[model samples]
Target: MKRILLLCALVPFTFMTSAQNSRPNIIYILADDLGYGDVSALNKNSQIPTLHMDQLAREGMVFTDAHSSSAVCSPTRYGILTGRYNWRTRLQSGVLWSYDPPLIPESRTTVASLLKQSGYHTACIGKWHLGLGWQQGENGKVDFNKPILGGPTAIGFDYFYGITASLDIPPYFYIKNDRITATVIDSIKGATGKGFWRAGPIGNDFKHEEVLPQLTQKATDYIKEQAAGKQPFFLYYALPSPHTPILPAKEYSGRTHTNAYGDFVLMTDDMVGKVLQAVKEAGIENNTIIIFTSDNGCSPSADFKELKAAGHYPSYIFRGEKADIYEGGHHIPFIVKWPGKVKAGTTTATTICLTDFMATAAALTHRALKDNEGEDSYDLLPLLLQKGVYQRTYTIHHSIDGNFSIRNKNWKLEFAYGSGGWSAPREKAARTQQLPPVQLFDLAKDIAEKNNIAGKNQEIVKQLTHQMEIIINDGRSTPGAKQSNDVPVNYLKYR
Candidate 1:
């Protein structure tokens, strides 16, 4: 009887060990300001040919109604990392600046931290706009030579090599594992036209055009190094390109017919190809899971007029661009390539938020998330494998300005009128005209969000509004113990 019991115990233990060893390496590739229509596979009319991105889409599961948590860079990044709404934090509107203090609190658990606890070698190699703790010098100047605290390393990532903010925002320098790679002794002047970057302090060796390539090389090198090891790795490769400074390398410049921005998109696609090639070269392609998504929609810096003239629509069939409350603002490309796990050449219209990444990782690693962690995240493992419908009750959307919108099934309700961001009939203009107090759209019938039926559907507006209030007050969308928001948030006040 003792021998039989020992055999039974060892059977389960063997299975558990095998499961741990089979955990796939995860690589999350985040594209900066790349829109849904930017990828050729998603949008047939896109002038910029994103072959590599298309290939990834074809080989993996593509989510059609995926969105960034917020309509802009910093907030979306915050939601992606923390699995909580950015509006709940002190920053209710706009993006964080280059030298802003760390936004993520020390106590907060990030996706990296969760995975790190699961024995994964985690690294964040790219734009970390969520903020960093820069050591201040005399007269409140940022000390670049010192090690910055409360950054990727401080949070959860074992290693970090990236820029602090957008490519355009400066203190233009590279940070490798919390330390500046070089001393910033000079100030670079701003440039106009396509390659636009704010004039600010820059490292002596930093170059605008070299940012994307350098980061790509670093990511590829990291992948190669990790592949040689037995431990499964997690890499958050946040891309800086197709966003600003539109500085494609000499070889990539003029590669597209849609001018500088399109050329930059092509370069971004090539970088994606390089990363994919790196995984394959390392002989870990089959065991690796690559998730390619954008931080948010395309910015107006891409020159909508010029792109339209060249027969390219960055927002695709959506109504507005990046910072608006419309679908285009947050609706982004979400593709996952998990070889032998997720079905290939499959697509789903399941609406998912970038915030879901945390919970998904937790599920993959067999870790049960605590109530305080991944507050807004829903496990997407089922959706990835197409096992069943992972129905989301609702998704809250935030704009560049402090406007709010809620989506429940096919119905959407915007709390404020106008674009609620940077678009025609802006908040001031719409208010001057005394537009409706709110807007409602049936997205299934009208994906463009053109016809608002708020006056007709009073019950839906009330229900959605009530749901939003509940979600806000509860401090989370997912089921858990009641939590508290960092600050006060009243979405209705925007009206």
Candidate 2:
């Protein structure tokens, strides 16, 4: 009887150990200012071949209605890592400056922190726009060489090899931890030729054009290093490609038939291929869960006119681009692949968001996260691995201008009178033409958001408004959750 009882106890322990060990390595690849229709797999009309990203989508699950929490870079990154809305933090309307202090509070729990606790090695390579504290001047001037504070390392990433902001931002250099590998002692002006870099300090070898090549190499290198390590790692590879001042390496330059933007996209595809190669070389292909996504929809400046002239619509069937509350602004290509784990050639129209990453990681690690934490994140592992079905009840979208929009089932609610965010030049001009106070669209019918049926559906308008308020007053999307008194100013928020 004693032996039998001991064996019974050991059975559960064995299952628990195996469950914990089964946690696959995670590689979260994020793109900047990429459109939903950019990938050929996502948009059949795409001219430039995104074979790598498309192969990823075809091999795994493609989330058709997925979105980013915010329609911009910094805010979206903040939401993705912490599984919390950026508005609740010190940040408000605009994005972070290159030298802005770290946006994430050390007290907050991030996906990386949770994974680290579960013995996962975490690294962030590429664009880390979430703001890193700088050794700044009393009057916005500081010792550039000083060890920067309150960045990825402090938050949870065991290794951080990326920049603090986008390429357009000043202090144009790649920061490895706190110090810049390449610096700008002299003023290196932007393509606009207006802004100037100060002469305070710069790293020895930093150059504007050198950033992309180095970053790509560093990312692949990190993957190779991690693959050889005994400890499993979580790589958040946020690429700053096909964004502003789009520049591609000589090998990829002029390689695309579209334009410079297309060429840059092809370059990004090459980067993905190289990273995937690293994964394969590591022989951990089946054990690594690889995800490729974008921060938000494409930006208006993506040479869309040029792309359209070539019979390509980067926004695809979507009506808007980045910053807009429309589908294009947040609806992005989300592909997840884990061989032998996630079913191949799968596609899920299930509405999802980057915020779900936290809860998924937490649940996978068997870490107990209170309801108040990761307020909007949902665990989708069951659906991804076990063929379980998940119906996301409600997905929220926030514009750069602080507009709030929500999609519940087939109906989408936008409370703004404007185009919501920067959709297109024509859409922006159309805002002055005509619009409703509260626009409601049955996305199943009007996927392009051409019609506003709010006047016809008063009940949904009322219900959606109430639901939006619940999220606002509670300071979170989760039921009955409220932000502490220290909640920052959420100016220009929903009416």
Candidate 3:
């Protein structure tokens, strides 16, 4: 009887261990403001060398039609973690700035929280631009002495280390698990030109040039520590590089010879290599799923003229740069590596959004999400495994200025008269010039989005417009029970 009881206990323990071991470690590397053509593997004519990212592309699947949910960082990040559109929240346009209240509600489920419930340890390192519950003093300044609230830790991450917002944003400091690493007793002057930063409060140790290297070291340390344990971990390494303050390390500066931005990109890729090395050294390479992507397309801060002069187009053949309603703004490079699961060197043209991460994780863990969770996320597992197809037919796109666009395969309909963002013939100018109220493009024939065919294809435009309204009114792009947006979304405001 004693032997039988011991065997039964051992059986359950063994089964549990087996289940845990079966789950793969997930590492999502989100590069800020990286463009499709930045990676040489994705863009053959690129002048910058992204060897590490290229290696990932060679060993895994590359998503050619992948896009951020929005043309900017904050919104895309919100969609990425929540699996819901960012516009559903009150932030209809632009990104969250420093000291902004946490965009995610305390009750909401995030990708990190969802995986944490599924027995995975989660950590978010790098930029937390989604927002934070910053306490303010009577003087209306942020209280640096108190612990922060409603941040990565509050949502789902077991551990969190990053900045309040972008590197260029003020109150420059490091945050570890809801606490500021250093007190902000000093200030720094803002700079312009190549490496620009806003004037604001800065911590003693928060040097903009050293931030990337510090983040990389922290990520590698976390990977090493997690690899020693049995529980699988998910690391969201949000890199703040090649964005602004294009301060490539001394060793990396001038290495690209193309420009400061190009040199910074090379540094970013090298940091990725270091992270990959950490995984390999930890012996978790085979059982780890590494996803490399960008929050959005390249920014104009990269100096498009300089890149073009060097015979490199950051957006490749896409029309506009970041923040535009065109393909160049949101379309990004997405590379996934899962040994033995995803075929090596494979490419998929299936359209997918960053929000899909939530559902994909659910599918990987064989868990069904509630209707209220992951409302806009569609499963990319089928596409990843190359055995099935994506259920998403039409994906909605958002511009920095809150303009809405809908893509149905090769056809795209933009509810904007002009670039909708920081491109030429801005909304005001276009309206003043009496431009059309809407723009449409057949991507198959005009991948650059140079021509507007809205009047020529009224039926297709009508169909897409109706679909966009339904997606917004239904509160989700994916099929589920009718959900509710955190706020009212009016896509017709620009129209």
Candidate 4:
């Protein structure tokens, strides 16, 4: 009887250990300002080849209706890392500046933190626009030489090497871990080009054109180093390419017929290929889970008119570009490649948000999340594995201008009267024309959002409006206690 009891007790423990050890290494490759149509695998009419991106999609599962939590950079990143909407934070609209205090509170749980707690090594390489606590000097001047506080390391990442903000933003320099790689004692004037960066303090050896290649090499090196170790690793390789300062390397210049932007995109694709190759060469390709996605839709800074003339539509069939409440703004390409786990060459129209990363990671590790954590995140592993049906109850969309839109099932309701961004029929113009107070679209019927059926769908409008209010008031969409928003979130006044 004693011998039989011992065997029974050890069985569950052994199985649990095996499951924990079986957790694969995760590499999340996030492209900056990449559009749904940019990847050839996702868009049939793409002008750029994107061979590597296509291959990844072919070998993995493609999420056709995936979207970023927000239509801009920092906010989307916040959502990805925290598994909570950025609007819940103090930053209600726009992005954080390079010199601003850390947007992610030290107390908040991040995806990296969750993975780290699950015995995985975590690193964040590339653009970190979520903000850093730079030490302030006299007259509120930034002390670049000092070790910056409240950065990636302070939150969760064990290693962090990247830029503070977008390539166009000022104080251009590179940061390794917590300190700037080089001292910024000189000012670099702005240069003229299709992709221009703002003039600001620049490090002596920091070159804008070389940032992408350097980051790619760093990421690959990290992967190789980690592969030799026993512990699994999580690498958040945030690419700062194909965004602004479209400086493609000489070898990649003019590689595409579209324009310089296209050439930059080609370079970006090549970078992805390099990382994928690194995983293969490291012999961890099958044991690694590679997820390729974008921060948001393509930026208008890509010179849409010229690209359109060249027969390239960055937003694809979508109506608007970045920062719009429309599909084109937050809708992004999400491809996951987990060899022997996720079925190959499969596609799912199941709508998902970037904020879902937290809960998915939790589910993968078999860890239970607390009520305060992952308030808006839904576990996507079920959908990815095709084990069961997984769908979001509703997905909230936020724009650069603080516009709010809610989507439930096939119906989408935009509380704003216009695009709420840079596109035509802006807020002022719409008001001048006496457009309706709100807009509703049957996304199933009009994917382009050309026709507004708000008047005809008053019932849906009321239901969606009430649902949105409930979600906002409850402070979460997932099942939990009613939490509190970090700030007052009034959707009516565009706050």
Candidate 5:
């Protein structure tokens, strides 16, 4: 009621009130493998500094208990764009590779496509690990000569620029539309060594060292191009930063407690600054919904050993880091700056997931969402706008191995016996300390998830289990009365 009343009061006072369909420009800035501790605004224990990102949080709203859809990359990206859980897809386990099939099916409605249908220009300008099927060559290599198939363009972005997968993956060339920004002339080893990336396909101008600069330039250029047009644009600015092989610009190297990882994160902050500047320079800062977040928690390999040796909690108070089913793997920093709409210097404890983006976009644009559209995504505009405590009802967590952990009304249940993805690779026997086959934590009481309370509360456990079953079987969570929007899409239909 408070939120609704607040919106009612705010709507007339602010120019941001929706017209029949005067949609706002949207910019989603995603950080690769960043943790809750990566940003100073979220964690003050002291690591790398993020000026631009911190500013973003200050100007908008910072969701302290925010989470990524999954603990790893490909799956989380699947959930982010589709607003549905990735596990629902055939990718029941691991992530996608550089040359894999499209993560999103043709029928599924992505934020880009949904907004595009509403007359908003959309573009994805960063890492696209969701996979773009590549054509093979005459000599039996990835025929870099072939146009990338089933990519962002096919997914609804009027303009697309990004990598088919992770930067560490071979065939490290950038893609503009369906063609490689750098052509393949030499054979480069694939990420897992399965395929050789035909190099030289990229221009002599392209180099791994120039990736951040390259993507930044392209994004700024795209913004500039969009500025001239009157179209309300949505830019999915997923940055390729703070991820492995930590390569920061020459000036950003050697600037943090951890190592190259922190350095690269700092560089990513500068990239955010550039984007924010573009929004301001375009004079659309207030109307643009600029959100900064991470795909998932920081990777354990990202200087974790060094940080542990130094007694620094990279994942902060969270038990596991990255791939673990623990909070650290999925808990991430989320900041939204909607100028006139969202309140400044405010924070929310709402347990929201990245999957809610689809619904949020649809709601703000006055479009409806079918129950199956992004079944997992509940509209969070109310929360972001600081209208009131619009509870998420529940948020589900998926581990790298398909293990599931669910959080609803403060009680979280993990279906796995132990730390699902954080196995101590070196010590097989040392893994016994993990939770039993099923562990439960009252996050409202034990935010650290240090104790398992499943045995203590049988009724609660059964109820949550029943709820989880319903969510899985029905293909949508049973919580709030779902709002009618775009017709639901069965992702499995075209798969």
Candidate 6:
């Protein structure tokens, strides 16, 4: 007890204590690949109206410079859960494949586990992209009958119901806890455009169109059920919509009158509305901390050309799309609503990363994290409560190709010259065309990143590069005891 109190004392701010032994119920809603401009409240020019997301923005605090730690889905999810840079893990680039071993070690302290330790009931519904430990039979086939290992249940979630990876990944089925709810006895074919899913083995009950709705129902059901309990509950509801297999249910189809993807965005918003409605109906709205944000920027599969034709820009004036090191890839919409605790219609441009959730959660619960845990996380309670300036000094961004970029105030330094992912002037092309080896931009002067001023700004480049090296070598951005990364992170050597 003394040690715990001492650690808590080391924390920067006083613990958020609404009432004795009372903690706010937390609901974290992560939209899969939803763009910064997709929310109408964030982007004035967005053609698709995201009423639910917009409502959250209007009622809560909107962060203009919020970013996912990585420019892709899996890495961003990893950072959010563990509060450590995904590059420090074995998955330096790209996403985990279906049937891959668990990305997070069983002993790692996750946000779910942390809350659970603090006497909160935790549940995770929808999209577990951080890989699962699936047992294989002698014939090299997945043993669906055997209980899966190293999943959400192993990590600390009391309840977990979600697909293994991205909806596009193969072996489609749902897992309740560590068991497969159904058997995979069918096969599927790959698709193109908005309805894009890889061809693979599928379960008898799995359907692309029903995934979003079913997950939504599960989330609402959980909220309603948990409201009756005396214990505070933490619900990490990750929506799989508006990502791929853009199959908006019949009711939402063509609802946007712009494109299939736009209609799908509406469907996503409806899911958010349902969750919000569930909290209100349960009478927990006043005591719940609701956060709505995206894992990463909108994927190119959303048909950027078609959306542009319709005058809707998902990236919203950003230079690149998903898998990029630019603002469009990692910069995302972040809204937090806690009735009476947060002022409505407030906005802050202070830069923050998704990894900050860890320390923020620690602050809320009045628990201090050890040096090894939440290595890259910083507490954002100050910014959320409008108490003072944010504690984050700089943010490190990662691309799908493992390239690194450091953002300090108005300047950004990209280690790679090209887009680093699927954007134009790829690594090979950039090198062939004799482009600069490194690119630096003064984001204050050129938010679009049209100008590369590295030639004239060598000192700023060197300074940011040094800071990045220190952050990488120290294995943490926050002040703490020295820690070791799971693996050596060599961001300079890109694939």
Query: Which lDDT value does model 5 have at 340?
Result: 78
Cand. 5 Cα-lDDT: 0.77
Q: Name the candidate that leads on TM-score.
A: 3
10 residues in a row with least lDDT, candidate 6:
12-21
On residues 1-495, what C-alpha lDDT tens digit does candidate 4 reach at each position?
999999999999898757645889999999998999999999888999999999999999999999998999999999999999999998888898858889998899999999999999999999999988888788687888888999999999999999999988878888899998885468988877766998899998798989999999999999999999878999999999889988888997777888899999999999999999999999999889999999999998899988998899999999898988999999999999999999999999888999999999999888998999999999998888989757478999998888899999789899787888878877778788888878999988898999999999899999999999999999999998999999999989842
Cα lDDT, model 4, residue 152: 97
TM-score of candidate 6 on Cα atoms, chains taken together = 0.95
Score candidate 3 by lDDT: 0.92
> How would you encode candidate 5's per-residue C-alpha lDDT over 294-351 as one tens digit per residue?
9888886576777666445658777777887889889889999988788898998878
lDDT of 6 by residue, 1-495 (tens): 999998887663444344423589999999998999999999999999899999999999999999999999889999999999999989988999988899999899999999999989999999999988889899999887789999999998999999988899987888899998885568888988779899988888898889999999999999999998778999999999789988888888777777889999999999999999999999899899999999989998898889989999999988888999888989999999998888899999889999999999999999999999999999888988988656788899998988899999999999887988888878889888889978899888898999999999899989998999999999999899878888988767853
How badly does each model clash, as a count of residue pairs? 0, 5, 0, 0, 19, 0
On the 0 to 100 scale, the lDDT of residue 76 in model 4 is 96
Clash pairs, candidate 2, are 136-142, 137-141, 137-142, 182-206, 183-203
- lDDT for each candidate structure: 0.91, 0.78, 0.92, 0.91, 0.77, 0.90
C-alpha positional error of residue 428 in candidate 1 after TM-score superposition, expressed in Å: 0.8
Looking at candidate 4, the ten consecutive residues that score lowest on lDDT are 15-24
- Name the lDDT value of residue 366 in candidate 5: 87
Query: Which 10 successive residues of model 5 have the least lDDT summed?
Result: 189-198
Kindly report which residue stretches of model 1 are placed more than 4 angstroms away from their true locations once superposed. 1-21, 388-391
Task: Compose the digit string of candidate 3's lDDT tens values, residues 207-326.
Answer: 988899999999999999999998999999999977898888888888877889999999999999999999999999989999999999999999999988888899999988899999
Instruction: Tell me the spans in candidate 5 whose CA falls farther than 4 Å from its real position.
Output: 1-21, 137-141, 189-205, 308-312, 388-391, 423-435, 478-495
Give all TM-scores, in the order shown. Answer: 0.96, 0.90, 0.97, 0.95, 0.87, 0.95
Q: Give candidate 6's error at residue 254 in angstroms.
A: 2.1
* Candidate 6: Cα lDDT at 343: 89
